[model samples]
Target: MHHDVPLIATVAMAFVLAFAFGFLANRLRLPPLVGYLVAGVMAGPFSPGFVADAALSAQLAEMGVILLMFGVGLHFSAGDLMAVRWVAIPGAVGQILVATLMGVGLAMAWGWSLGAGVVFGLSLSVASTVVLLRALEERNALATPNGRIAVGWLIVEDLAMVLTLVLLPAFAELLGGHADGHGTATGGGLLWSILLTLGKVAAFVALAVMLGPKLVPWLLRQVARTGSRELFTLSVLAVALGIAYGSATIFGVSFALGAFFAGVVLSESDFSHRAAADSLPLQDAFAILFFVSVGMLFDPFVLVEQPLKVLAVLLVITLGKSLAAFAIVQLLGYPVGTALTVSASLAQIGEFSFILAGLGLSMGLLPEEGQDLILAGALLSITLNSVCFMGADWLRERGRARFPAWFDEFGKDRQLGLQGQLDELRRKSQAREEARSLQITSLIERFPIFADLDQAGREDLLMLFRPRTAQPGERIIRVGDRPDAAYFITSGTVLVRVSGQDIRLGPGEFFGEMALLSGRRRTADVTALDYCQFQTLEQRDFRQFVSHHPELRQKLLELVRQRTEMNRQAAAAQAEPVPALPAQG
Candidate 1:
């Protein structure tokens, strides 16, 4: 029974091999990513046995890139980037230039064309987002000052690559590669292409920064109100994927860049934490596919065919790029520890390198061997990236002990200043989280009706509540007045006057729902007995929430019925007051 299910076959083989190799890698104390890559190699066309569909794997890997970048953007705020801009901007640029120069020099010695050399050098200049994020996350340094700097540096490199990708085609004919006829090799056309690409990128950024925060949050809240976990998760994924896809299609930017901005926009919303939590599993799984897909691209024959060339490319990626980053950071007045961390974080090239090399090959700018060398270098460097971090840690410790002055004297003040800013940012983030937690806790404790809500449900309820306060003797509701909202008393007391009877209610009690449910004017007068706090759910919001949660709606209906009976009894007793008084006498 044969079926046309290449995608399923690819995904299954990829996962199975990844798990097996990943398990073995863990047992051997290596990064599981190393094992994942090895698995991909085994399932690749170059290896024996089954060959997974490379195209499907690549597409899946693209999704992984999109989601991984989105996840990173959720945590990385503009404030964090600005905090380390002084070091990140110049350091990243300077390091790229240095690394590129080194690559160009090496390529020159091999008598390659200038275009090939430039493409090769540019490919080696950038680091892998997936690898760096994983390394930082594993060490719990993603939110650290150094980590922010490294991430910020990577962002700069990504932006540069985006521009390079745009300009490369425009300059193809000029640089000895056949142009695809979209752009001219003339200087004016090159300038125009550059300006156009920059404009598109800027427009996309502006739109995301200006409109995305407003729109995405509102959409999320709307979906959240539906009380569907799957829908909310779907919505989050939709927003991520949609924005990524839209930005790329409309703005001519990379999908990774687009997804990143989508995340940054959503990060400003109150639901950011929940969104991040909900989307994490998918992001991680897809990110694993990214590693596997990368592995599938490796032509291991390059290792045997051009050993020295492969080694040279690996050196440029690992040693050359790292040393340049280290020197640039130190020169930019960052501490040795920071320099080491940033350096190690960037010791491997990834997605962009593959993209550039592929483009180069398509344009006939780079030879096949160049592409193979880049792939081999990527594979080897990624595998050894963990060791690079370990080495950096060891070197930092040794340096601290042997040359304490280097750590103490170099960039100490600047490092402290950056640390202070990072701490402030972290404190603000923590405070917001605590405030949200306290809100949920208070709601569950004070309101039994809300006790059954899960975290997402509680968060949705919180969003609907419009907080209110009333002073003593203030009439919150008047007899025969139209109901606008239902009030839940968080604190203080209120008196509900029905007929001649006064019913007192304290914290956790609520009023104003009877009129809302019955679709009539208020039948009772409610006044604050003392200073009061309330969470008022407006009629529209109340109906929407209640509709989504039928159980809660039923509970409210029951309360309304009970209140109606109590009112009737009170009125009847008031009417029979004369006979009651006579009997008492």
Candidate 2:
């Protein structure tokens, strides 16, 4: 009973505490993320209860970071980002600069080193992806123009943070921290180290861009063809983990960067949606672990011992950053409402802050207090993030009432143009989806045999169908040819000549299956009577599909029996023709 099971114990306790706190947080009308952090605090070494293994928690948390970043990359849309780039790119960068300077000033007042100040400032600059998305969703603004700007703003911050993570280690020694494998070099030597790091990252990106799209998608398609859900899921995990590990080991890049690129590459594949859906649960679970582990690093004493320091960090996150974002958006000629929404959205730090703090602490660039302050800021800001949204809304309503002309005149034309572009994009996306749905619907409506299958089965059948067309007099099947596929006529007619008898198949009818079912060559020649359209199901797919749906298989078998009897009677009558001719003479 005393066997060493730290992994199991840590995982089990983390989840249990997370659930309890998460449920409580939900009932309190706060984000469940708040509860997850509380759970981590309860299980942390700083707390009095049973402590989880610190090392094990850290590794699990690392995996959480990887999966979290991967999810980010998977959902990254270039078109969406481009739509709001004019406001988002500048606004986010400006806010980051203002927030970082504020944090650095605070750190200096506390007698911390410049390196510590830089790391601290950077940590407070970015907002939590989960918190902002959830807030937007709760307000039903996720699909709105303001929501798009906020999301695009967050993406810029994430990209900046990724580059910082890559370059931080290279300059760690120059920043007065212990070098992490990059030897302490001054002047040109330091420059070379930075260049080397950038070079490696570039190389890795190049390889990922070139090979990943080709290999990863091919591998996924192969696994998908197996019709095994578990295998497909496993393949996704393998790609995420494998690429991350490989990049870190071979290319000397960070796991976060590697995983992000992996997702970006996979996102280009047709399987991206399925891959994201299947891997979501695991990603969410690991993301929770990540939050819990970050909580464990927090020392509650910091809140009391350095109350002003914690408050200062919160100001940088919620106030300084928000004002900067507001100003930048206004300068870009956006409406006041849009500016406030973007500002409110950036008023909290989450995963990236914790990640940056942990890396800085490990490299000796940031003090323990810096990490503690970041954690405190994250908890307080996340808890208060909802209030920020409410405040923005209150201000917007008041502004609209008090200065109606100002609201109408400011950015009115620009706003309309932007809204028009967004509407067009949405219409195009919806049209594409509707077209695919219509095709599936038409297939089932035209062929009642497919009506028996459920939604998923119908979709699978659609994927298996190969569309084909033939002109009048075109031979679709030749006598004595091996049966390879069964064709369903969707338009016009096809003539099947069997044993000197001619049979016509119009829309919704099928031919060429008799040989496939009987394991023989074609017994008839099928020729198009007019221009025709068909959906052909290959022999392999047909067998597999019918095997899964026995009812459909039975129906096909019954048709085969009826056809065989009809052919037999025709042949028997042909043989008795001589007797009929003698009677006539």
Candidate 3:
């Protein structure tokens, strides 16, 4: 007699194989997602090894989609979505339309049904949020302007897909596809189905927006106060899974949509950052399983049986979509760098494509062969996207180097319009800075030297100071470097090391003054303890200020004398021997 243990066996094999393959892929400088998918194929029924429960894997994959969408919502807000709307909204939607049309043309060539063509086209339209984010993060470009546009474009695609998932069932007949279990609805039935679906979606969004924002954050805070790391992690998971299930059960919304709204509601909270951190590991585990599940559904024979068909699909996804984006961004007057970055970012499809394919297959709108082709295209595009990015980077660097003068002129001309807008922003920022400097100058007046200065004299002194910034662990001043200016700490701390001594300096402290006055190299290494902002008075500026203020000049000399004597004494103390140690011995 055999023990029935499908769940344990499948999970165990999936994890083991995924780890081995993922490690190898990373070692080869490839994305581990490729490895995970390969692992799934090996464990799938199509391959020779132990096959996982297909049904169970599908359910797990759905959970991954839900959580991944939720994570997107958690990190993004309406403001963020709107920030790049000028490019992202039109760019993403237009690219999708173009890609879908290209896919339709390919499907027509293959003599597939309109329903199959629509499904296939949709499957190629959207890029994987996970893959795109990972790619941008790897290149340290996620915080750049192009990255923001890419992310915003992704949000639009996600929202569109969520809408498609909801309506696909209601409009199944129109698309020449069957509805789920129930027969296809038409006329009044179709109208009712559409209204009901829309109503449920609206209700879920309303409830989540109204109640979830308050309750979820409060609940998370309460869990946090319990001071148990395990409980906090559990709470985060519970919120994601519970809200997802409830939305689907009570409101008839898809799990992915529900979870996305749940995350959006929670994103409003101050504790959302911690919540994201707590949920990361669980999210990652499910994401890996998700890729594995997609792999399990893929039939490798599709590549051999229909090589040209698969190539056509890959072209639509990688080339068609990328070209559309590049053209759209360029038309919007962005530089070539921004256009290439956005274009390259969209050259791969993954999670969303898998979801769309699965849905279409379940609805009988897409065939098994179609699903296999989609999976094949996704794999190839993802692998090749790396190569595409490397190429883009090379061209960008070489273009800048080889045609520096030409590129400079071209870049300047392109930036002329942006420069005007930037100038307005700069003026506003300068006004704010001047206000802040006025406050600082008032504080400076409390010092003995500045007390003698009249209002105009103090204003003149402020004009001589220029702002400087340093990041944590940055060396602001190195030993043996000739000093040009003395720095006045405005905020944060710095550590100054001279001869074997370390001195901590806080706001209101100053440094490099002795070097500036004496025309000598710096004796100490000054490093920022944290992000720091300071103001500097150059030697020339200081001398000019002192020339007009003899009393302040005398005060500075006196302080310098005192500091020099203090340093001498400290050095003598450090050199002194410990004579009393003999008595202890």
TM-score of each: 0.88, 0.93, 0.70
lDDT of 2 by residue, 1-585 (tens): 787999999999999999999999999989999999989999998999789999999999999999998998998888788888888788888888888898889989989999998899999999998899899999999999989889999999999999999998888898889765656889999899899999999999999998999999989876765556789899999999999999999989899999999899988577788889988999999999999998999999999999998888888888999998988888999888888999899999999999999999999999998999999999999999999999999999999999988776898777888788788878987897799789889988898877888766776677778899999999999999988999999999999989888889999989888888788999899999999999998888777778777888888899999999999898788778464445664
Candidate with the greatest lDDT versus the true structure: 2
For model 2, the run of ten residues with the poorest summed lDDT: 576-585
User: RMSD to the native, candidate 2?
Assistant: 2.5
Residue-level lDDT of model 3, residues 506-529, one tens digit each, is 887788888876778988899999
What digit string (tens of lDDT, one per residue) describes model 1 on residues 94-208? 8889888877887899999898889999999999877798789999999788888999899788767767875676678788897575544577876776688779888999999
Q: Model 3 off-target regions past 4 Å?
A: 1-3, 398-585
Tell me the spans in candidate 2 whose CA falls farther than 4 Å from its real position: 468-483, 514-533, 565-585
Model 3 residue 329 CA deviation in Å: 0.9
lDDT of 1: 0.86
User: Between the candidate structures 1 and 2, which one is better when assessed by lDDT?
Assistant: 2
What Cα-based lDDT does every candidate model obtain? 0.86, 0.89, 0.82
Candidate 2: which pairs clash?
none
